[model samples]
Target chain A: MKLIYRHLGAIKIVALLAFMVFVCLPLVQMTLLAFVATLPHEELEVGQATLQNFSGILTDPNLRAAFGNSIAYVLINICITIPVALPAAYAFSRMSFVGDKSLFLAFIAFRITPPVVLTLPVFQLFSALGIVNSVFGIALAHCLFNLPISIWILQGFISAIPREMDETAFIDGYSRPRFIWSILIPQIRAGIAVAAFFCFMFSWVEVVFARILTTTNGKPISMAINALFGFQTDIGLVMAVTLASMAPGAVLLFAMRNHLSRGFRIGQV
Target chain B: MKTKDNSGWIFVLPAMAVLGLIGLIPLVTVVNYSFFEIFILSSRFWVGLEWYGELVGSARFWQSFARSSLFSMIILLIQIPLGIALALCIPRGRIWIGLSLVVVALPLLVPWNMIPTLWLSLLNPETGLLGRLGVVLGWPLDWKDSAVHTWVVIVMMDVWHWTSLVVILCYSALTTIPAAYYQAAAIDGATPWDVFRFIQLPRLQNVLLMAVLLRFMDSFMIYTEAFPINAGGPAEATLFLAVDLGEEIKAFNYGPSAARSVLYFLIIVTVAWLFTKAQGKLEEKAAP
Candidate 1:
């Protein structure tokens, strides 16, 4: 018991320091390089750094369109996923059906299925549906990946609440929908935020569907970066775009800062 | 704790329908494709499991599969412990907690495909800041030249990108431990290991299952960063199954790729099923 009691705090500090160095090095390097490389069409100087690449997000038509497309798809995916997942999670926790358990478990199975497997089939289906090459198509395509996990997380949070919350709400003459909205939703705000955060993150970072579905038009920022790498190999512009891609997620993580910490307070298993 | 109601299906109905269109139907299509020799969608001729048969017998398929399995195994072994350790080390002090969480979650926001681009810049020996630093430290990586070095960088990149998830989850599990429990441990003069083994580890079990499953499935299906990293270079030493599948898809080998997808998907689904079953057991144990 006394073996390491004296050095525990020091150990934690050392670990945190090591983690910070390891986690931040590549990112820091990227930030440094983003300044050094010149933007597209800019004549390279021997040692002069450039801020022109960061401004490319606003100035470049493809990048601007890609950013807009990426944001719209992410918002659409969350809107579709959260509303769908919430009700399913609510039912899984509060109500019992014949195959409810199996159905819930089935969601996880689909979630684990890789996006690569779904590419050709998704492209084929969307082309037939005529939603191909649109942000909406990419949004819907991401649902297959994000919905299951969102439901899983929401169900865990929902189940953690006491059953009495439901019983009392019902006895007080609230309808099932009303109870879920006013009382239940607020109570699980953190879960919803966590789920939404995940959905946003997944849709934002996903390249397979973004690449496959948006071949002709409506490319997301990831594809835009891919284009830059393929065509110009501009390190500065790529890092700038990559950093730009992270902006929404950073804002979201800050928004989720409190809720996320509290989100899993009930345990998400 | 719950009521028996068939109307619950009403709630599940929307997700079911959406997923049916997006998930189920595509899956069915893939399964259908696996049995055919596709020359464009319309020109596919029925081959009756020929692609799967070939995949099973082919040495190339098996070797890539074996290589991918080995990579997943190594990362899982490294990342799980590393994640748990980092999570434990995350101080709950008021000032640092929020910033730490935001920093930890930063990598998850980066597009998965660009991880390679980011790493490539960092590993460019002449130009990259990190690459230059490595040289200055007198330990330079032959990242593009050696298969072993490429593997190490890949592993390191994954650890950097993913360990935060485990830390966040473990933090949650730790948060669930009440102050009373800590006070009790303090009185008992329990060692750090004892607290971890008894109080913390028990709380972590549920989430660790989640973490392990997520890590396993992701590491198994890793494609985006890996494909772009070295493009399966250094004599094809890093041709993971997913990367190999990517090559097949890019080459327009539709039938074989679809078959490979089917085989690949089944492996994941089977593991997820087992995970679900195990989770059910854990829930049963935890119910009381």
Candidate 2:
């Protein structure tokens, strides 16, 4: 107890308090605003807390469909990103191909490519393909950018695992698919979890491409939340929608706060 | 180290192909469009760097560029050191460790758009804490109209939104340091300040560099929040490069927009490269 207090006494108290305030402020504001009725001038009425806002959002078919679209897109994004990413990660981690380093860098380069910049070309192409305003279109758009990051991060994790595992699996008569699914995967389970979480998070919260690609039927929660902006601002509904959109991520992060911190700490590598 | 399949390309080919068609191909198309003059349906001519020249010559583009750099710089100035300080404050063990991490991790889970909205209301003079306090203190604080205030709001919004990233990164890096090193520092009679300077700061170099680069890139490319608040209002004062490029894309001025994007891409790539190079040197010096 003396040892702990000696080192952490003053500094720990200050940091812990500040950090709690910092983390809690926005969330508390968001949660509170989402529940109450708006005052006359776009403000939350101090005494008007209710679950009516949640009911208002849930009952709206458009909001429901938007929720559906978001879920579908997130799932599709994970499916696309993980399968392709796993193989590409393995290749980059293990293979000696021409321009492998350059190719990997190129993938990293795409991760940094601004969606605002890429929006035009994708808009043009998807418009031509008649896939604009579709869930698949948004999924494709996300997968394009996110695939590289998945490879980069997953490659790092995959590389850290021993190669002998693969050899041993093969020698035990495991096929390539079986070896990967049975042996290689379990070794990098944490990596897969981290990578998949990020992939889902990015796809879930991504605005620009999702906005650009989907028109009505496939509109995501981010875009839908933006649509809450009426001429006379309904701060309550807007806050409710925004809070609803952010809830899953907030909950997930809270639940897996340690993993999330470690993932960020390690540079997602 | 999985070498059972030399045909790993077979697995990767599908993904690379899709990414190429959607991601890389469009970029190539953007580059191609930048170099050509296109008219309705049937007119195409080699413009040969004309769009690039126009982009460079435009005062608007330069203004937006300057704004972007300024925003990124201010965010870095505030977030990096603040993050380090916050990381330094947290107690290092399992119980408080879990609680401390959960505390810092909260801000990051909020979506980008909600951040500005929350602040916009929180600083509203009627019901907002900041706004009501400002009124009581007799300082007429208006976040929307004044350019300097807009900068403050944006900076605050960014700091609120992103500092968690830095804190988490630094804390993660800090936790990985072996306990014996710190114990040794203490045994050597190192003060808390001395231990942090000599040990913690050195260990944090790589993660700090990563934090800086991520923050710079994200802040520089900021669009959604800035657009919603002032909509680049009050004579384009808050019109960062993203807003300017957004306008071009909105107008369907494909040629010039593509050119500007290419230029933007090159500039960022250059800055990131230089940053990484400097970080490499720092990492070398800080090496144990």
Candidate 3:
């Protein structure tokens, strides 16, 4: 019986090790392939590693511009999302409004709507305004997708926070705005951070609408990465762009590693 | 819960305004466009039900709808249970939790474009590890040329990317299960399975429903990763509704695309509504 139990423990360990290795395989390959002199065009290889691909992409002006645009767009999205969502979340969490439940669900319903559904109308709308390919145009479009998610997650977080906090602040002579800014904001700092990270990440990585809306100057990194998907593949450039695109999200997650994971766990549930 | 301040309205205005201007306006536009015959974005003629009739009658549109719905169903059927199991395995406490989380989250942080690219290379039949191994072992795996293979690749990629979402959600719900619940169960001589079945599972219902709905909606609208992988190829085997809609929009077939989009939205909204209703029903059943 003891021998059987020991064998079972060994099996579990082996399974865990195998699953870990399997999950990490793509990351390992991507890192190794990025610096490789020549990636296997049709298929990946255990190749000779070098820094040429990364250098090539970084040095290109257009690529740099797109990278910059991605950062700017994400920053704009965060700014727009935080102010808009924080209040809406406060309303949903604190007050009972007419049509509150259904309205909240409606917002989520819109969030769940596929971007493709609105693509042409948005194109026409932007084109009519002569901002079809502009940064602000793309940023507005991003808010359409990201704001509801931000509000939903923030509402969840705010609901989890006790209502007594709000009443306590009110009783202590805090004005509404002051109370929200000074009292409520501090309490939900973690939620705000989580919302901000998600808004940034979604805006940073979105491709479909980004592709349709932005032509040149406002082209984000996902669009830039799309440029790498060619029939005649330049694996080197593709690897370079892929790595460059993922780097920010990767770095941010690494920096706020614990918090980010906690956010995902909380935000999702 | 005061209705008088209207200050709460001020808070909601920006988000509502943005959503209204961009999200809501376009939707209204799409509905309006679906009733017209549009050409070159310049001229349009009112043609009520014409585009809808054309879309509904088109075998291609129906085929793609079927394909997308099936794929989403399959993903949910597989991912939810698998995610719950993975979440169950993860122990509570800060020790080693950080490292484990990093492991789970690494794949999720990879760019959307990168996911398909990673899978494409990983499953490469020549020098790609899965491909090379399959050839050597005789699995005949070729995603680029086979619909079955493409679906498998897409499913695998999705599972890899999103099971983390479910796992993390379930984990959060699991951890919040107070020690007293388990202790009380154990004191009553409940088995591990009994504890999970009676206490843990019920607590997880809301989150699980959310996970399922989120996955359903996301997978139904899947495009970015799937598009780059095969471009909906292999004789349109992997061609889902989004891909079909994308092609239509790309070709500037605005009327038909709008009609199709409406149908797609209706289907998704219906499913989501059904889910919420079901959740409400479950809660009512649990009420004393």
Candidate 4:
């Protein structure tokens, strides 16, 4: 029985490793494709890898603008979302006001509404405001979805903190703002990190709004990548840009892996 | 436990304002536009529910709706079970735990637009590793001509992209389970299945419900990945609801598109409501 159990354990490990390889295969292919100076039609040869694709893509004006725009708008979206969500989430966790339940439900409803449904209306709305193809516009547009989710996740995180913490802080003569800044914030730093990571991820990866809301001026990396899909672009250059797009998210995930794992348990993300 | 503090309104006001300006206004505008015959954004004639009527009577709308529902169902069926199994199989050591978590999250971090492109390159028969392997295995991996192959690829891509979400959630829930329960089960000579069935599954109910809700919503809204893959090709076999809506918008058919949008929103809201109700009932039943 012991021997059989040990063998089963070995089998499980082998299966997991196989699964990991399967999951990573496409990514590995894309990375390799980015490096090699081979077209989709040409056969890949060993040791033919070159850095030209990377240099070629990085030097392209449109691709460079897209990279900058993507980073800018994602950061802007995170900035707009977190501060607003923090107070609202605090309220939901600690206090009850009129229509609070209904308001909360409405937020969830907004989160559920498909971005495609809002695409046309948002395009029209932004056009009227003369903010179409602007980074601020896309950032605001993203808040339509990101804010609710951030609030929801932060509310979960805040509620998990003991009520006594708040009570004790008040008794110790810490002003509300000071208490939030110094005491409450530090306690839920992991939650904030997770929430910020999610906001950044969603805004960075979202393509629908980015596609419709911006045309040329603030075209995001996703839109640029999609444009390449339309024309007969070189596969190597496309792969390089795609790989570059994954870098920010990869860095964020690695940096906050611990907070993310913890946040999953507490924030229900 | 409720605190009677209307002062909370002050806290919620900024978010509410932003949400109202950005979210609710557009939503209301979409509903309003559904009732008009819109030639353009600024030019419209009052049509009074004609678009909605047309949408309801349209065969394409029904087809896309059914397609979307089927896709979401398949995603849930595969990802949930596979996620649970993988979560169970994850090695319980410090380095293994950290490595697995990061590896699982890698796919989720890739931008939505790049996902289809990545898969396309990987499945390209001439150059892709999978394609070459398929050739060796004598399997027809053509996505262009075979609807079945297209569907298989879409499902495979989705499972690969999203199973990590389920794994993470379930793994976290598993971690919260006390070791005492497992020890008791072992002492009682319980089978591995018995230990899982009694202890882990019960503890997993809440997180699993959450996982189901999220996976359903995300999959239902899937467009960025599916569209770039085949653009609802192979005779429109993969033309899900969002892709269908996108076509209308692309053609600048604002009226019918708005109606479709409203209907799509309603379907999502209703299904989500039903899920929440079901979850509440389950919790009530589970509680002593």
Top candidate, metric DockQ: 1
lDDT by residue (A66-176, candidate 2, tens digit) is 888888888888888888899888777777666665676667667777888889889889989988999888988998767986786677677767777777877899987
TM-score of each: 0.95, 0.89, 0.91, 0.93
Best by TM-score: 1
Per-residue lDDT of candidate 4, residues B120-167 (tens digit): 888888789898888888768565788888999999999999999898
Candidate 3 docking classification: acceptable
Model 4 DockQ reads: 0.61
* Models, CA RMSD each: 2.2, 3.7, 3.4, 2.8
DockQ rank, highest first? 1, 4, 3, 2
lDDT per model vs. reference? 0.83, 0.77, 0.77, 0.84
Specify the CAPRI tier of model 4. Answer: medium
Winner on TM-score (2 vs 3): 3
After TM-score superposition, the amount by which residue B26's alpha carbon in candidate 4 deviates from its true location, in angstroms, is 0.6
Report fnat for all candidates as fractions from 0 to 1.
Answer: 0.74, 0.47, 0.50, 0.70
In candidate 2 the C-alpha lDDT for residue B231 amounts to 78
- Residue pairs of candidate 3 with colliding backbone atoms: A35-A50
Residue A49 lDDT in candidate 4: 83
lDDT of 4 by residue, A68-187 (tens): 999899889889999999989888888888888888877877887788999988888899999999998999999987898788778868887889988899999997668878988888
